[model samples]
Target chain A: MYIPTYEDMLAAHERIKPHIRRTEVRTSAYLNELSGAQLFFKCENFQEPGAFKVRGASNAVFGLDDAQAAKGVATHSSGNHASCLSYAAMRRGIPCNVVMPRTAPQAKKDTVRRYGGVITECDPSTSSREATFAEVQAATGGDFVHPYNDPRVIAGQGTCSKEFMEQTDGLDMVVAPIGGGGMISGTCLTLATLAPECQVIAAEPEQADDAYRSFKAGHIIADDAPKTIADGLLVPLKDLTWHFVSGHVTEIYTASEAEIIDAMKIIWKHLRVVMEPSSAVPMACVLKNPEAFRGKRVGIVITGGNVDLDRLPWLAAS
Target chain B: MYIPTYEDMLAAHERIKPHIRRTEVRTSAYLNELSGAQLFFKCENFQEPGAFKVRGASNAVFGLDDAQAAKGVATHSSGNHASCLSYAAMRRGIPCNVVMPRTAPQAKKDTVRRYGGVITECDPSTSSREATFAEVQAATGGDFVHPYNDPRVIAGQGTCSKEFMEQTDGLDMVVAPIGGGGMISGTCLTLATLAPECQVIAAEPEQADDAYRSFKAGHIIADDAPKTIADGLLVPLKDLTWHFVSGHVTEIYTASEAEIIDAMKIIWKHLRVVMEPSSAVPMACVLKNPEAFRGKRVGIVITGGNVDLDRLPWLAAS
Candidate 1:
């Protein structure tokens, strides 16, 4: 297995600079008081596709050679990665295809279609998703972009922490929510070389704590299915992502489902940004373990803003 | 009635610079395509107090003489103005008193208290609010800062349009939600001097279309108690605000309750920002009158972000 270097991250930043948004770092005095720390939120939720996934998707799409580009790119994701990859492909005028679960939200499906991505629906199980994706990739002869495990994708995600470090000075720690470990792996890749003194922490929902358990066991632990309000963070860690997470992550924290929902409401009330449930886990972690973050300058990556408007977690019957 | 000059707006900007936020202007490709017009959103919902009311409230709180400053400031708003004024006064370490209807959302009442303002509850009636405010003023000897009917407040609100004009070039029209006409009046005051070529428009809920009626009649038409989902826009226009409204407004457009809710959902889904119902009116108007706004560059002011999270208008029983 090949490891992506800091040099690759630098090249990815240069390549994907104009294609993705340089999302601003936002702060809230109210949130500061609640957490007892000076917090800077790197608002990836403000990205064009409303997620940091755009960075990796754009990097992979733009790096393809003319011959490979003609065949386009293919991905199997039921979330932001699918729509974001589609958006990046559309920007370059290439044909893109997505294999999505039939149970995925209609809004998410519509977003992918709006970006001109052809969607092939599969059953809601993991085996079915992988089987369907294989068939589609074989038929289309397109470049396959794994959401988190690909070296190019990880290098692309590394640019987020690079920009965060440059956007603010003297960050004591950085926290991000982890699912498939894509964002956390990217943070580790950048921080390991650029600012080793700055701690990198990963947060996860307790209901879906495979990453936390994997960290404790010092090995990759796969969860076939995990139930949580944070739909984005249900996937277990892959080998490439686990390599970075196990080596560079300082700590892994977990928050309960109720606490995550409460944190989401607080962010909406104070920060005035619409964030999905998955994006609130890091804040919930910070709030729950104040001593770890107290009096520290903390940078939190707000992962995404794509949400089902009619079925907000707080509004849902729990 | 005395008019607030452009010079007064400049002075207010200078005085409130340290206290208020210079919110960024955001654009949406989806919204532009939907309306067939280039749209720029002035996101006042990102303000420190989560509303543009803080700009005016801060100006009023800071501009007081030493003697008046000792006495602090007072108001009778059941919405954003009350809490924003409290936040401004707390920043100055001055006394802030508010006379509010007891029936106002508990979240709003809590916000006022959180800012260290003393709340005086009154019956949910216009006469009761006015009468209770007079008694409180007499007892506290605080300077009364009428929410939208004061020159200082109007001048402070005018700075938003000035910043909008500087942020985005060549806006053909500026649209803002009108309640007591404070924001629309400020837009008129600034644009009438700085960008006379830009048409100024006001949007209101059809159920509480007092501003539209007053604009048509060439006189102020007071509504004692208008029922609308836009709680912040239920108040009638006053003499000072009407002066700017009658003289400078290009058009007053009204949207139905359903239309406002639809637009609010669209903004939350596409823009990924939490905006209150009143703030959604301008976008609703643009959607309803695409022909009036098509093929033009438009600026829309997002007024505030204060809402009862539990009782969203769309979730309310119809």
Candidate 2:
């Protein structure tokens, strides 16, 4: 298992700063009063390409030397990471090839194409995304940038927490949604170095709690299949990410699908920000377990705002 | 016609400081690049009661002396100002009686109820509204807070522009949506005193262009019955507000209904903020008349975020 050091995160920040948007920190007085916790929202929803995945993708794309960058980059993702990598690669004037599942949202594919990426779609159940990605990498001589397992990618995500800490001082705890664990690993590493006193917490959807189960068992646990409104958290925690999680993350909390939808509605009604289901996990966790975070200066990473407007979860009648 | 002095605006700022939220300023790199203007958005949409109307409503409620305050505050409004006054009066522990047209949106009426205001429904016609409001005022001895025509309200709104000037060093121009002209009057007064060199522009919907007509004709122009998606801007300019608008406001620009919808979509898609059609007016003005503001520093006042989510203008099929 590979684990990134604090220095790697700092290096990644330097490499990715020019390519990604330094999204602002937003605070809500209403949320603070509701939970009795002073909350700081690290708004990655406003990041370039509309998600925090850009930070990692930008770092991975730009980390290569000039000679290596000329060959381009390749990745397999059915969501934000694919579009992020494509956008980052396009900015560097390099070609990008993405192998996405046929079931991937049309909006995600459209974003990737808009950023000049060649897309190869495959069946989600039968086809090997990795093999397809490998074939593209071999054909184009492009570097493979894993969505979460890569150290450079983890370090890139760390920059978000770094900026979060700098924006507001004395954060007692930092909470983020855990998918394949790239964002949480990077966030944990950065806080461990800069603000050791701050506790790093992970929020996962109960229906897709592979990371939560893994943390409790003290081993990497893989779920055969999972279902949750937070599709971003459907992936199991990888070994490389598990190493960082075991060492630095304090605890993992889970939220029900209903709670996630409630959080989304609250954000829209009060904050006037359109946050996707994945980004609502942290807030849902806070609502479900207010005792753990009450009266604490908590920082929640609002991961993204890329929900399809035509199919908004809140608008759906149960 | 009477105009407020700079000192009057400053006094209003001090009086309403405790009651209203000092809304934050947001700058978008994407908007800057697209508009060819360095834009700073003063987020009044995040203000208490979710609009800049709180500043004026709070000032009006708190400005009353003990005897007058005991009588409480009353207003006839179908939108943000009604809710603002209702909430403001609730905070002061005074009774608020709002006379709203029966045709007012249910979402807005719900907000008024949430703030503990007593609502009196009247016909949509002006004669009925005036008659009902006068009867209510006479019966309860409640002090009437004219939506945008009062001196105190204009002074209260001035504080927003004052804060904008303090937040960003220099501004080439200040743009605001003009409904009944209170916000623009306040903005113009603040800039004229502190940033005399800066241009103050009013943005109005072409469908409700009474302010634009008045600015052009050099006299008050009334729109007896106007129709626009920006419901907040349906009122005609008042005597006191018109005095300030005529003297200090540099120019007036109008945007078509389609343009306002486009601006609203842009903000929702890129910024993830739910700006009402009225709030989008200034942004639409910039988009419509790019040459007037290109390569310059612009300050846009996002006046409110009080929109009926169930019936957002853009959501309706064209």
lDDT (Cα, tens digit) per residue for candidate 1, span B1-318: 788899999999999999988897888787899989999999999998888999899999999999999999999988899999999999999999999989988888899999999999999887998899999999999999999999999999999999999999759999999999999988999999999999999999999999999999999887757898888898899888989999999999999999999999889888888999999999999999999999999999998887777777777872
Estimated TM-score for each candidate: 0.98, 0.91
- Show the lowest summed lDDT stretch of 10 residues, model 1 chain B: B309-318
lDDT of 2 by residue, B211-289 (tens): 9999999999899688999989998988899888999888999999999998987877767776688999999999989
- Model 2 misplaced stretches (Cα beyond 4 Å): A18-22, A90-93, A116-128, B61-71, B90-95, B116-125, B135-142
Q: For model 1, how does the per-residue alpha-carbon lDDT over A84-105 read when each residue is reduced to its tens digit?
A: 9999999999989999999988
Q: Model 2: how far is A211 from its true place, Å?
A: 2.0
Instruction: List TM-score (chain A only) for every prediction.
Output: 0.98, 0.97
Q: How close is candidate 1 to the true structure, as a TM-score?
A: 0.98
Runs in model 1 deviating more than 4 A are none
Docking class of 1: medium
Name the best candidate (by lDDT). 1
